[model samples]
Target: MRGIRNMVLEILETAFIQRALVTGIAVAVICSAVGFFLVLRRHSLFGDALSHMAFGGIAVGLFTNIYPLWTAIVVSVLAALGMTKLRQSTKVPPDATVAVLLSSGLALGIVLVSISGGFSVDLFSFLFGSILLVSPDEVYIIIGLSAGIMAILLLLYRKFMYIAFDEEQAKVSGLQVSKLNYLFIVLASITVIASIRLVGILLISSLIVIPNITAMLFGKGFRKTAIISGAIAVSSVIAGILISYAANIATGGTIVLVLVMIFLAALVAKKAERTKRLAGIKAEA
Candidate 1:
C-alpha cells in the first residue's frame, strides 16, 4: 500500500501524468453526459458509427500531414451533420444510416492510408487511445470542449428530456425538435473527436455505452442519471489510468476494461437487490 502511494505520488509529480489525468476526466465527463441522453434516445449505435468515421479523418491527417485531431474533429462533425441531413432525405432508420457511414468510412480510411504508403503506428494511438500522448495543447482542447458541451447540455436539458421521452409531443408542443436533434448529433461528434485523443476510435464506445447503460440500470431522474453517468465515466478514467500506470499497459484498453468491470459489478448488485426485493414480497405475503 505504501509503495503504491509512493508511485502514485511520483506520477502526480510528473507533468505528463497530470495532463493525462485532466484529459481523461474531462473527456469522460463530457462524453458520458451526452451519452446518457443518447442512450435514452436509443442513438447509441450512432455514436459508434461516428467514432468509426473519425478513422477516416485520421487517414486524411496522415495523408496531408495535418494535425490528426483537427482532421478528425472537422470530418466527424461533418459526418454528424450529414447524418442529420440524410435523415431528412429518406425513410431510412438512423441505424441504417449509421451503418452505411461506418462501413464506407472505414473502407475509405483504409484505402486512404494504403494509398499514402500506410500511416505509422501512431494511428493506433487514435484507435485505442493514448492518454500519455496528450500534450498540453491537447489538454487545453479537451477543457474547452468539455466546458462548451456542458454548457449546451445544461441549457437544453429539459428540452432534450422531453424529446427523449416523447419526440412527437415535443414537436407538437413547438419545441425545435429538428434543431435539437441536430445539436445532439453535433455534440456527440464533438465528444467522440475529443475522446479519440485519449481513448481511441475502437474503445471509445465504452465511454458512451458503459456509463449510460449502468446509469439506466441504476439511476433515477433524467438529470440525475446524466450526472451519475458522468461520475461513473470519470471514475473509470481515473481507475484505468492508475491501473495502466501500475501494469504498464495501454491506457485505453485498461480504461475500457475498468468500465467493463464496473458494469459487471453493477450487474451483480442489481441481481442481489432484485432477489432481496422478491424475498421481502414473499415475507409480506
Candidate 2:
C-alpha cells in the first residue's frame, strides 16, 4: 500500500500527467452533462457523427497548415448545423441524415489523408488519443469551452429537460424547440471537439455515452443521474490515466475499457437487486 501510494505520488508529479488529469476532468464534466440529455433524447449517436465530422475538419486543417483544433470546431459546428437544417428542411429521416454525414465525413477524411500521401503521427494521436501530448494552452482552451457549455446547459436546464422528454410537447408549449435543438447540437459538436484530445475521435462517444447509461440503471431522476454520471466519468478518467501510466497502455482505450467495466458492474448490481426483490416476494407468497 505504501509502495502504491509512493508510485501514485510520483506519477502525479509529472508535468504531462498533471495536464492530462486536468484536461480529462474537464472533458468528463462536459461530456456527462451533454451526454445525459443526448441519451434522454435518444441522440446518443449524434456524438459519434460529430466526431467523424471533426475528423474531416482536422484533415482540412492539416492540409491547409492551420491549427486543427480551430478547423475542427468550425467544421464540426457547420456540419452539425447542416445536419439539423437538412433534417428539418428535407424528408430525410434523422438517422438517415446522420448515416449520410457520418459516411461522407469519414470518407472525406480518409481521402484527404490519402491525397496528403500518408497519415502522420500527429493524426494518429488525434485518432487514438494521446493525452500526454496535450499542451498547457490546449488545456486552457478545453477548460474554457467546457465551462461555457456547462453555463449554457445550466441556464437552459429545464427547457432541455422538457424537450428531451417530449419535443412535440415542448414545441406545442411555445418552447422554440428547433432553436434549442440547434443550440444543443452546436454545443455537442463543440464538446466533441474539446474531448477529441483526451479520448480521440474513435473513442470519444464512449466517454459521452457509457457513463450516462450506467447512471440510468440506478433509476434516479435527471439531476441525480447527471451527477452520478459526472462522478463516474471523472472517476473513470482519473483511474484510466493513472492505470495507463502505470501499465504503459494506450490511455484513451484504457479509459473506455474502465468505463465499460463500470457499466457492466452496474448492470450486474441492478440485476442482483431485482433478483433479490423477486425472491423475497416469492418467499412471502
Candidate 3:
C-alpha cells in the first residue's frame, strides 16, 4: 500500500504526467460527447474516416515542414465539410462516400510518407500517440479546442439531437438538416484532430466509439448515456496513462485496451441482467 501510494504521488509530481492527465481528460470528454451523437446517427465510422483524413493532413504538414497539428485540423475540417457536401448533393450512399474519403486520405498519407523517405519519429508519435511527451503548448491547444467544441455542442444540442434521431423529420420541420450536418461533421473532424495526440490516428476512433457503446448497453437516456460515456473515457485514460507509466508499455494502446475491457465487462453485466430477468419471468410463468 505504501509503495502504491508513493508511485501515485510520484506520478502526480511529474510535470509531463500532469500535462498528459489534463490533455487526456480533455480529449476523453470531447470524444465522448461527440461520439454519443455519432453513435446515435449511426455515423460511428465517421470518426474513423476523419482520423484517416487527419492522417493525410499530418503527412502534408510534415511534408511541407509546417506544424502538423494546424495542417491536420485544416485538412480534416475541409475533408469533413467536403464529404458532407458530397453526401448532401449526390445520391451516393453515405458509407460509400466515407469509404472513398477514407481510402483516399490513407493513400495520400502513405504516398506522402513514402515520398518523404520514411516515417520520421515525429510522424510516428502522431500515428501511435505520445501523450506523455505532450508539451505545455499542446496541452493549451487541446484544452482550448475541447472547450470550443463543447460550447458548440451545448448551443446546438437540441438541433443535433433532432437530426440524429430523424434527419428527414428535422428537414420537414423547417430545420436546415444539411447545414447542421455540415456543422456537426466539422465538429467531429476537429474532435479527431484534438484526439490524435492522446490516442493517435490509428486508435482514435476506438476512444471515440467504445465508451459510448459500453454506456449504451445500460439502455439509458441520451444525457445519462453521454455522461456515463464521458466518465468511462476519462477513467480509462487516467488508468491507462498510469499503468503504461508503471509497466513501460505504449500509452495509446494501453488506453484502448482499458476501454475494451470496460466495454466487455459492461456487455457481460448486461447479458447477465437479461438472463436473470428471463429466469424470473419463467419462474412467474
Candidate 4:
C-alpha cells in the first residue's frame, strides 16, 4: 500500500504521467461510448479491422514523411466508410469484407515497413502503444477528438440507439439508417485511431468492447449499460496506467489485462446472483 501510494505520488509529480492519464481516460471514455453501440450492433470486429488498417496508414505516413497520426485518421476513416458502402452495396458478407480489409491493411503495412527500411522504435510504439511518450500536442489532439466524438454521439444518441437495437425497424421507422451507419463507422474509426496512442492498434478493440460486455452483465438497459461501461473503461485505464507505472509493465497490455480481470470478476458476480435468485425461487415454491 505504501509503495503504491509512493508510486501514485511520483506519477502525480511527472508531466508524462499526467499526460498519459488524461489521454488514456479520454480515449477510454470515447471508445466506451462508441463501443457500447458497436457491441450491441455486433460490429465488434470493426475496431480490430480499423486498427490494423491504421497500421498501414501509419506506415504510409512515415514513408512519405507526413504526420503519421493524422494520416492514420484519414486512412482509417476512408476505409471505414468504404467498408460501410461495400456492406450496403455488395453481396459479400460483412465478416468476409472485414477479413479482407484486415489482411490487406496488414499486408500493406508490412510492405510499407519494408519500403521505409524496416520498423523503428517509434513505429513499434505506435503498434503497441506508448502513452508515456505522448507529446503535449498529441494530448491536445486526443482530447479534442474525444470531445467532438462525444458531442456528436450525444446529439445523435436516440437515432444511434434505435439503429443499434434494430436496423430494419429503424429503417422502417423513417430513421436514415444508412446515413447513421456511415456516421457510426466514422465515429468508431476516429475513436479507434484516437486510442492508438494509449492502447495501441492491437488492443484498442478490447478497450472498446470489454467494458461494455462487463457492464451488460448487470446493467438492465442501454443507458445504464453505457454509463456503467464508460465508468468501467475509464477506471480500467486509470488503474492500468498507475499499475503499469509501479510494475514496470507495458501500459497498453496492462490496461487490457486489467479490463479482462474486471470482466472475469463481473462474470463471477453475475453467476452468483443468478444462483442466488434461482435458489430463492425454489425456496419460495
lDDT on C-alpha atoms for all candidate structures: 0.87, 0.94, 0.94, 0.92
Q: How many angstroms is residue 232 displaced in model 4 relative to the true structure, after the best TM-score fit?
A: 0.6
Per-residue lDDT over 111-222 for candidate 2, one digit per residue giving the tens place of the 0 to 100 score: 9999998899889999999987899999899999999999999999999999999988999999999999999999999999999988999999999999999999999987
Give the TM-score of each candidate. 0.96, 0.99, 0.98, 0.97
What value does the lDDT take at residue 45 in candidate 2?
A: 91
Among all windows of 10 consecutive residues in model 4, the one with the lowest summed lDDT is: 3-12
For candidate 3, list the clashing residue pairs, or say none.
none
Q: What is the lDDT of residue 125 in candidate 4?
A: 93
Candidate 2: 10-residue stretch with minimal lDDT = 99-108
Residue range 60-175, candidate 4, lDDT tens digits: 89989999988998988998899889999999998998997798889989999997789988799999999999999999999999999999999999999899888899999999
Model 3 Cα lDDT, one tens digit per residue, 1-285: 999999999998999999999999999999999999999989889999999999999999999999998999899899888988898889999899899889988999999999999999999999999999999999999999999999999999999999999899999999988888988888899999999989899999999999999999999988999999999999999999999999999999999999999999999999999999999999999
lDDT of 1: 0.87
Which is the better candidate, 1 or 2, if ranked by TM-score? 2
Runs off by more than 4 Å, candidate 3: none
